[model samples]
Target: MAEEEISQISAGEFEAVSQLLSSSESLQLAFIIMILGIIGIVFGYRKFSSWVGSQKFYYKRPHFSRFVRRAVLPFFAIALITAINVHTQTGVLFGEISSIEDETISAHEQFAKILNTFNILVIGYTISHLVPIILTKREKSILEKEDFDAWFELRGFSDDSEDLFHKLYKWVPPNNAPEDIDEKEFQELLNTEKGRQYLEQFRTSKGNPIGGYEKLVDNPFEEWKKSERAKYEKYYQNCITGNNQSGRKLKPGTKPDEIFPIDVWREEKREHGYESLIPSSRPPGYAKKKREGLPKSAKQILPLGIFLATILAVVAWWGVDLIVLATATGGFSIGLGLALQETMQNYFAYIMIRKDKIFVEGDRVQLETGYNGYVHKITPRVTYIRDALNESIAVIPTRQLVNAQIVNYTKENKLVPAVVKVGVSYLNNPRQVASILVKVGKRGMREIVDTRGRHLVKQKRCPYLDKNKPSCGCDKELHVDATQPVVRFNEFNDSSLDFSMWLYVRDYGAQFKTKTDLRMIMYEEFKKYDIRIPWPIRTVYQGDEKKEFEEISELDPDRDKVIDEFGMGDIGRGEGDE
Candidate 1:
């Protein structure tokens, strides 16, 4: 397209198209073909597209559809642009009277046309690529064939080559005991309708349906011999024939049991031997039916193709109109202004957060506003998080999440060894108490402790720090400037020495469970040692100390020195009431 545009046609590429046009005599006809070439691009593309739509490529891989959309747009664009380029760059033929310079105008016009064609090709490929995907179809490949195979192997059926009918012998257990079969598995086979349908199709196609001895019997040469003797006769004949080996030449001393008879694998019993090659030959669909497993089908890629085509159509007409309208008049771009405000904010913040890579789903995150929760689902617009209690969920906008201070409990790593604190008697050994608390924490949530994470978590590297060593969850990270409670001795109580000890936690949600375990372990461990938690104490005083009479009480008793305590001061004598 570029070569054709700006009259920048390469000599070889021009010659290739020019040679074909020269063979035709009519210049007018040649010009029309160029027009049709532009038109044929549309037609050929539709034909190619119709062919593409017929194919079922993405039937199984419905999830990975965005890649198809991204690929398809570019392909259509390139094909259209190339066709237009081939048409325009090879200038339409003029009569012999025309000079090369006379043809320059048509060349320039075609060049402009090619340039404009390509410009339309690539308008907004990126926005549609990054947009949230909502495909037309939504079917999961639930009944994968392998799940069925595992289910079937649980049953007595072997692989395809082992049908077992040839070596079939029903075990005539000494007392005719009942056979054991799983009802759940039998029910599952019947329940899987799609699998059953596929199996029926496969069986019909192969002209077999897992036939048993009775189903295959049809009739005997002697239907007249319908007695019990016939049953025993057929059974014994097959059994003894396998053991006898009448066809093979044998040495005189070699007995049937000693000669490794095929009938009885264990030489102790020379009975009818059976091998399992028939079941292995069973069609793959048979196993699937037996196990209630079904083969996966591909997703409909054409729906995505049609959807992208509509997006392109809208983008071309509406997008070009908007741009052209604004460009023609000096109108303000209200849409651009509104779009940029939100888009730019999200774009920059998404970059920063992605670059930082601090938190992920399932982490307990606390906002600066005191909204604390477990990260449930993170969408582009909002993040849904369950509160620390796990009862209520909070929807945090991207703007708030990006602007606010966020802390993750399982940020660095999981298996966060947490501690429990109690204000017990000062006599208690804080070290033993810490040990017991840690033990309780380990045993309490050992089952629920999740270890699935990046390699860094397992390796215990930087960023995924070990909080217990020097860092603790109770305190805000030292690097962060946030309100954190440093150690404080708030009071001195009566029965026990009061102090606050902040401890670590794996997550805030686990706070309740860890607290319970800690209280239990502390109670159990503190019983061995006499550690008591004290309550607040208050003291009582009898007399009012607001006014003092201490100096008058020390004075030697004299009629002149005696003083009153009721309305008393350290004064001499009062004669009048005033």
Candidate 2:
């Protein structure tokens, strides 16, 4: 089209056209044509503007208004200006005002024709390329409408809310709304101020419906089973399987489905995929398995590659002498040997860790050296322990961990066994002491009181609840119910009966507080019962006669004076020591 325009516009034709346009009548005609084009652009913009939105159907299509404003209208406007310029300047749009050698009116006219050809090409290209694209996009909007209607039908949308649906389609909810909305949920959501704000956002921003939202029409269990059956069938057909060690093969008379059911076949197929030499081997449409993190080798590979590259680059760039190269090679060999040694040691530690099922990350552990902390991370090189007492991280080499004994507080369970040892004077009855210890251990004084208060409140709120019901008929058992404290006599000390009371606590970190509380409670109980914790009694033998001190008390005010008069310190002094 552009070439034809250029070829037809000869020197005579260009002069005639320019002369005709130069006239006021011809200028007015050109202005009318431009005005008509502008009107056409406005109408086109308005016709397509309604469908443009953040919604998928509208979003897929280019905005008609933008194309008109940016491309169509601008092109016509420029063409109008070009025509006017040719009329006034003897057909040359960019003609120089200064008189130049070999510059002719015909040359200027030819230049105008060439410029017009470029404009024609651009306009023609837009028509040929852009029109079909825009036209094809019209189907998306139609399809969206059809889907919307179909969804309402499937979901049994009330006909009474037809007006509301129409309004929603015409104007989207506010931008802050969920892209996919159920009308009932939308209504309920709009009851709140936040939801109202969201709706307003959806409306303002022209939020789109979620893609395929309407298509998710069924989710029945039987239908799901059917779908799963079909999926398994596809998997069995495509995926390979191996015979069982039992040599169980379908007999000639037996049906394959009966001998090896679809469910069993599916499981076998899955196991095959997992045990395959190729990790990526999977049945068609199967979801890709997700890895929690990068493999150890993968993590190490990048750094190792960089290190090797750096060594090579340094050697090449420096152009080191033969002696230097030999020296470097020796150093490299030594370093490699050391690295291999460390790597082997770490690998052994890793094997030990796995084989023993030792404390994993997150377990509270106390190392043999009395370093108590949570296992933060376990890697081949080192195990990171986060020490709560010191509020710092302790990095212990894996080799050291493998050699040392570790007390895993919460390895098997979060609950940790805790003991509080107490000694009371022999004057107190052993049976009574043990009973008191058991009582205190079973129900921690303050903790028991709080638990009772909570239970009372719960029972009061729901009066129909059975008082005898364990854990109030809930699946969860209370921590108090789970850990019944036990008391046992440890040993008889010189002046007191030693006993240890044991109980379990949920958090391993709570051991200290629990011990403190239990001890305090036992002390109060002992004081109430007048059960004394006896001080040590001393007997002195002088001149082959033994003198026994009865009911000796450390709190006795005159004890220090008595000790001084006896000269016990001098008597206990080492021989020949001044």
Candidate 3:
């Protein structure tokens, strides 16, 4: 792949392209026409290219053409494609529209239309991230198994765990020296420059005090665990779902109680009330509520807001396009705008979203329209996302981010763990998988599962496992070796099945690369062992020919004949087959 990329495109190819554009008659005519009419399309591209050049992307180099197309195409394409779809659906299928309105496309289609606009915005946001900037890809080598394991445990771009507690702060109280040396002599060791340097990288990142610092921030995790109210809040906040383990839906307003004393919690939900009409899910219709308006995650006046946003975007582009083009030739009529109202609306919404930071570069966002991943870039009205699969980046409208439940792991904190939940067939050992996963994850991330942090999670009764929930695998789901680790079988799925366990890793910075490597390991292991990773399959038989079958069968007959002739011992003789 690397070779193909380098060999296919080079300075020579670029020069050829330039020469073709400059000398070709069609290109020359096109240039002349563009210079006379729609000059903004030409000059505006250059201006935007210049503007883009000023912004620095750490890694990727954005080409002028890529910049121009991404920026301008949305302003035009959104309105144009939307117009085509709407015009066709409205005019030609006028009769069928009413008949098929309910089921043919359903409410989801209309929602899809709205989402398409928003998806464009998401695409625009993602493009920025794809434009790589400066990156430090320095590698640290570890030879010893323990060192490698330690590196794995702390692979995340985070501080060492102990250093957080053992922050070497100021006012170094001299260490007690031997009776012959005395305390003053030991103070010199504390004053060394080397000791101060050690404190900065390890101590500061861990939020520790430098130079024998005594200041200690109160333990937030411990504090939360102690308070009765805190425990209940956490129980609900850290609620485990079957998607991660069990597929069972906890009773609405479910809280820890029957297992633990009710008094243990300061307050638990008494009524199964839906907290928000909107669900945290990215898809629009996925909201938990059955209501008229949009999901709570969506801006309150969802559909209307989307419609209005569309109009605004169309206006911005249409107006600018009209004014700019008019200066060179003629203006577009108001009738054009009216005729393309819905199209314009979608375009307008697209721009409005891109202008706002509803989601931007590096934000991990899931759009209402099915696009989900880290925002790679935002240009004009479309945003791009490097989807979770990391296969190909998806482009969506910025409006989609606004309309979707934008889950920003980095917005608040950068340490987001890309979770991998494993579910196996009946009677399969989950403990083994868990151990394998931990080892695999640590190896990939060079980080460790914070066993020390394990003690922090002390629940009276583990909510992860229950017999009644369907999410909990059938009675067959077994977690026999969980005598120590907080591992459990929570639920079942169609193909294989589910285990949920919270792993403490370095943090978010290490998460992407770590998870990627771990997933690769999983794929290799699965393939090597002939394990079937669940996926949809369909078999197509191109009418087998009896003649073909007979011909092949005749060639293999000697195998069965050999077996018949010499019993099982004949198998050893069938090695070389030309």
Candidate 3 stretches with Cα past 4 Å from truth are 1-193, 202-206, 211-351, 354-356, 386-410, 420-578
Task: Tell me how candidate 1 scores on lDDT.
Answer: 0.39
Question: Model 1 over residues 1-578: C-alpha lDDT tens digits?
Answer: 32233243223223323443443455436446556654665566555545443333322132343445445545555555555555545553332213223353353343434345444444334333433233322211222233223222222222222433222222111121113324454345445764333322221112222322232344321221232223233333343344333433222112121221111111111111111221112222332243231211123334455457755454453334434433533334555667678766755565555568656666777778787778776554566778866689887665567877787777664433333445654444333333333334333333222223211111111121222121111222223321111122335456454444332333455445555654675576445433455444544645454332343223223211212211112122267643
Q: What is the number of backbone collisions in each predicted candidate, taken in the order shown? A: 21, 9, 83
Residue 337 in model 3: shift from native, Å?
4.1
- Mark the regions of model 1 whose C-alpha exceeds 4 Å error after superposition: 1-104, 107-331, 334-363, 375-385, 395-419, 423-492, 496-511, 526-578
lDDT of 2 by residue, 1-578 (tens): 43444444333333344443443454446446655765775576444443332222221123453344335544654566466545646523233332223345443443345345445544544454344445544554454345344434222222223333322232234434354566677777668866544443331112122222222224332333444345444433332232423333322112112122232333343334211122114332232122223125332344455445544443343343434444546656787878799877987897688678797766889989798899877778788888967588888888888878888887655565568887886655566566666656644622422232321111111111123111221112222334245567779887679888866655577666678777788787666555577666643525322212233232233433333332222223488875
Best by TM-score: 1
Order of quality (lDDT): 2, 1, 3
The C-alpha stretches of model 2 lying farther than 4 A from their native spots are 1-341, 344-357, 413-415, 445-483, 536-578
Q: What is the TM-score of each candidate against the true structure?
A: 0.35, 0.33, 0.28
| Model 2, residue pairs in steric clash | 173-202, 173-203, 174-199, 174-200, 174-201, 174-202, 174-203, 175-201, 175-202
Q: All candidates' lDDT scores?
A: 0.39, 0.48, 0.38
- lDDT (Cα) of model 2: 0.48
Pairwise lDDT winner, candidates 2 and 3:
2
lDDT of 1 at 415: 35
